[model samples]
Target: MDHAVVIGASMSGLLAAAALHRLFGRVTVLDRDTLPTVDAHRRGVAQSRHAHGLLAKGREVIDELLPGLSAELVAQGAIRGDLQRDARHIHGGHRLARGDSGLSGLLASRPLLEGQIRRRVSALPGVRVLADRIATGLLAQDGRVTGVRPADGEPIPADLVVDAGGRGSRTPFWLGELGYEPPREERVVIDVRYGTREFRRRPGDLDGDLVVIIAPTPEHPRGGVALALEDERWIVTMAGYGEGPGLALTEFADYAATLPVLDLHHLIRNAEPVGEPRSYRNPAGVRRCYERLSRFPEGLLVIGDAVCAFNPLYGQGMTVAALEAKVLLEAELRPQAFFRRIAKIVDAPWDITVGGDLKMPGVEGDPTPRMRMVNAYLERFHAAAAHDPELVLRFLRVTNLYDPPPSLMSPAALLKVLRGGAPRAVPVPA
Candidate 1:
């Protein structure tokens, strides 16, 4: 392709630009926000103030696309830790046993992570990052996208166009305007809300642990995560399903104390807050079934949250976007084939995200029999993981996208679960 224009300059857009740079003569990425020159938040991404966990697979793929990127993040103050060893995880109302799982995870505020990747991608041979430009619509001829029409400027022409805009993307509406059928969509209302604050990190916080994740359960619908980010600070995010954590500092700390585990609360109780607390509300998880669209425009494709926006709790969004960029690097630029490929990439994480949400009584979804069976097995698995470090490794591997869900049902894994700890009396919401 002579030129490929990608809309949005966020993490997904930058990755798409990097991938297209390898195949196209010139790759341009456009975003409405005048992106920051430093590790600072932009008005475009309010969620950047919240916690962001770069799963292991995501870190690996991003580093591959922009070599030595992980080291760059860590050197800039991002924390790198073994997923199981340096972190504490509480799920299914039980604290999972910690061990060296060898899966490496990266933790940095969303702004820093996105800023570093944007810096590296902008340095690519054929990549360009254009800021403060709003993509109003796509320009098309002969049922193929030909360029992008910005809000206030002349149309920027391109041989190919990719939509990497996050949840707010307007690609479907653009498709409808072009006389193409909009992709079918699947949505599960989660009503997730978040409260986050940054705190000064000391030497012995959480007894030297780098990360702590306390997952919500049926009985207690609240969850929390604290990560040691760059700049010697800790970013803590507390969340819940319906009535989530409040934005007030007192409310945030009080909500943390309600979690099933006290590690998150303990870390924040004495730590001094660095800034005003921030909050975000995600009402639902959405997936546009682009792969099922019988017809799509040539010279156009969609990636990232434009295609699927999962529940943030699973920390799957960035990893899924990075995987799609990798697929784009290798696949031919056929829209149908491309969507089909990315659909498979979205399946695992989508399932994991929705599955976790559906476990709560307040989330609206009809669980399939298989879902029920899997959830039941997972409850047992989580209980076993508390006493068996091997089960913890297996579960972490799956959650980190390193292993398939079915791997947990393997004979060896089943043996470990069967012979491990007995299930405790887990409370169920009546």
Candidate 2:
């Protein structure tokens, strides 16, 4: 293979570049924004300031890509805590039971995590970063992608093209222009809006376990907060649904005051804000059915938000992206088949994200009966997770994208739902 060109140098793009570098001679990552040298937010990644947690699976993938990356993050003040024991989780006004699962995770800002990955990936041989470059269209010949064209320059040629351009990608348009029908799309509109504020933790604060309070709603909205990134820094976010108004600082404080779990609110009230409140509005969930396309071009692939963008509130994007990169590597390195195997590998994470998004009311998409069933089961699972510690761990593992969604319906989980009384049936997985 000559070289693989990856569009967008965000988390997904960086991971794709790493995978491609291992398979091909060279990899080039093109991004419209100039990434910062330090751990600072950028315009392209609007969700950077919001609460971001690296689930167990995502952490594992990052470690594989860059060994000791997790330890480095921890050394830089990222908190590594047991998901159940050290994290307070409230769902639908109920406190989720803490499980003894050795399932732990890194709590850091999106910028911090992305910056770490960028620094490591940039140091790798056979990889180059092209900042301040926008991908204008695909370079295709005989219906297969040849490379990418930037907005103000000549086309850059490559043997493979990976679209990690994110939710706003123009891949569909380019594909359609090439006479390849665009893939089927599923969309879910939650009308979710978010406002995030960072705070400097006071002395004696953050000594207790960190907390995540999930307030759900169709009209009034849902929100959450947690200690993230640097020590003594908290990233608090408030989200509203439907026609609900954006959250102001005063409004955020008022909403935090009403959480069923009062610790988050109390912490916020006493703490000082590190920056002004930033808000983001997401109108819908999008899943492009690339695998369903009758004739997907060879030497081309789509990953991350470019393939399937979900509600960030779920925190599934990074984990799903990491898993996709694993799939890409497996397919590329295998001897017998490549593109054929690639399609199947991307299916798991795609279904997980799209299926969950279809659950939200007012979401736009063809929600087949199977999708509805999956949503129903997850609702029961969430409700059961509140009281059952074993169930909570399983739920965490699944949500963290470590185990497949089918793990939720395993015999262990089923027995917990069947047998009442404290709801502990299986030992938590390490």
Candidate 3:
């Protein structure tokens, strides 16, 4: 390919450019929002200021795609902690036993992670990043995408155009304009709201735990996570499935007090608040079934949130995008073949996210018999994980995308879960 143009300077887009820089003569990445020069949040990404976790699989993939990236992040103040040992997971109202699972996650804000990756990808040869450029429409000829028309600039031609425009991507509309059918969409309404705040980090705040997650259970619909970020700060987010907590400081802290575990509440209660809280709401988990399309234009492709935008609560979006970018590295970049390949990548995480959401009431979905069985087993697994470090490792491995979900159903894992302890109440400070 002589010149390839990618829409939206997102994580997926940047990674796609990394994969294409070696194949194409020049790659141009365009975004509507002016890209940030510092580790500051941009206007485009709604969750930019929120806490972000780069799962173990995501970290490994990005590291391989851009050499020495993770190390640079840590050196720049990102926290690297063993997934099992340094993090406390309170799920099914059980604090999972901690052990060194050999899986490490890089904890940083979204701005830091995206900014670092953006810098590295921009430095690659023949890769140019252009900000404040809006892709108004697609330019197609002879059933193939020839280029993109920018709102404020002249049309730029290309051999291929990749849309990483995220959840609000206009590819469907563009396809419809070209006399083609749009892909069918599958959506699960979650109505999840997030109230996030930053706080001054103090030594021994979490008692050496670098991250704490209070996952909502069937009995409790509220969830919260506090992660240690760079600059000696902690970004804490309190979320709810339907009616989330208020973003005001007092209300946010009050909601945290209602969590099954008091650790998150105590830490934020004692620490000095860094700034006013910010809020975000995700109405649903949407997946555009582009792979199901009978016909697609050549010289065009879609990746990342443009294809599937999951519930941000699971923290699977970035990881899955990385995996999709890895697929592009090996595929021929044909729209049909590329979409088909990424569908396989989307299946697992989609199931995981949707399955977990269905466990809560009011989330609209008819669970399969298998989903019900797996969810029931997971409750038991979480309860058991509190007593068995091996069980914790098994579950974390699956969630991290290092192992298949079936691994959790193995006879050995089943036996371990069967002999585990019951869920107990987490003690709160008086």
Candidate 4:
């Protein structure tokens, strides 16, 4: 019977296990941290407490993997609402024109989402979770991975190995020890920092709308705020660019009071803090050119942040991981060729994320002329989205990874931008 071993019991790891469980007879998930009995924050995921949203495509992927998950989340007190109708979006100090695309999503804590997915994955036939086990290195033969060795002792043999370990993955070192060159890496760095605080939603909080206040970076030092998760709770995060310090507890309320968008600020003013603000800083935007590696080990693959970790502000990591899991399911039938297929599938999100990150003034990377043109168009598209609801929907569709970036440059979309006038103000419902 075929057995698969996945390192790191993260959302990406759990999803990898789910994908492998469908193809292999048995799947073992290994994690260095002790798995929590409840949906609570752990050391493994430092960003768990921060605000996270499931884009329309991500919601669809999760629903496909675990049927009724969206509804289940709602049953568990998560909010479900139309993306445009209920969402308050701001770009470049202007509120985006609301659209009626009916693209709705689930709002839940990262811990909650991870817990649900873990529960569902654990219930899969022949899948088991092994916590507090650290993967030290790969056991290989003839230059191909066959299993993994735990830090304590003994090797866990498997027909396939997947590294879903997050940004700090040791896959590159393990591959090098096996006499294979590491994949080419492309990195873009933006000095971004964030401080997040959760609040208990008061009556009439949000005014029945999901709050999303965003400001562009490079030019604008301060970032944005998003109110998500439980219906009665809000996770508000304040971010800053360059070397700017993130918001402090004493300053968070004051900072929120100044956003160009009033809805988020209003909600913050009326809401009561549920927890202390947590701060985090991210400087690396990485893309591993694993697909370009000519001698990648057979029966071994890397997914999620192990492969490419984007800026958290983009909120693309979880969605891209889910999309990658879906791609893995489709390619599992041909394990030998699966990595190549998965590599191609990963390109879409990588482009969207890395491309966007490169836009920051101080970020360093190679942006081909084509990429520059693409970014140029997107800038106008974003500006246009502030006025045109139809254009905004299309932009959301592409930004959410439901469609390719090229889709934003389609003839129809281009014409919309060419003919679309400057951004128009949208009046808030009183």
| Highest lDDT model number | 3
Per-residue lDDT tens digits for candidate 3, residues 236-279, read 99899988888777787899999888888888777888977899
lDDT by candidate, in order shown: 0.89, 0.74, 0.89, 0.77
Off by over 4 Å in 2: 203-207, 215-221, 243-247, 258-260, 333-384, 421-430
Tens-place lDDT per residue, model 1, 1-430, is 6999999997889999988998999999999998889879999887888999899999999988999999998888888889898999999888999889989988888888898899899999988999999999999999889999999989999999999889899999999999999999999999999888899999988888999999999899999899998888999998899878877777778888899988987888788889888889999999999999998999899999999999998888999999999998888889999999999889988998888889887999888767777787788788888988888998988888888888888888776776664653322222
What C-alpha lDDT does candidate 2 achieve relative to the native structure?
A: 0.74
Tell me the TM-score of each prediction against the true structure.
Answer: 0.97, 0.88, 0.96, 0.92
Task: Give the poorly placed runs of model 1, Cα more than 4 Å off.
Answer: 421-430
Residue range 136-236, candidate 4, lDDT tens digits: 99999986688999998789998888899999999999988888888888887777777788888766666667767576544555667676667578888
Decoy 2 TM-score against native: 0.88
After best superposition, candidate 4 residue 249: deviation in angstroms? Answer: 3.5
Root-mean-square deviation per candidate: 2.7, 4.2, 4.3, 4.5
Backbone clashes in model 2: 3
User: Could you tell me the lDDT of residue 158 within candidate 2?
Assistant: 88
lDDT-wise, the better of 2 and 4 is: 4
Give the Å shift of residue 106 in candidate 4: 0.7
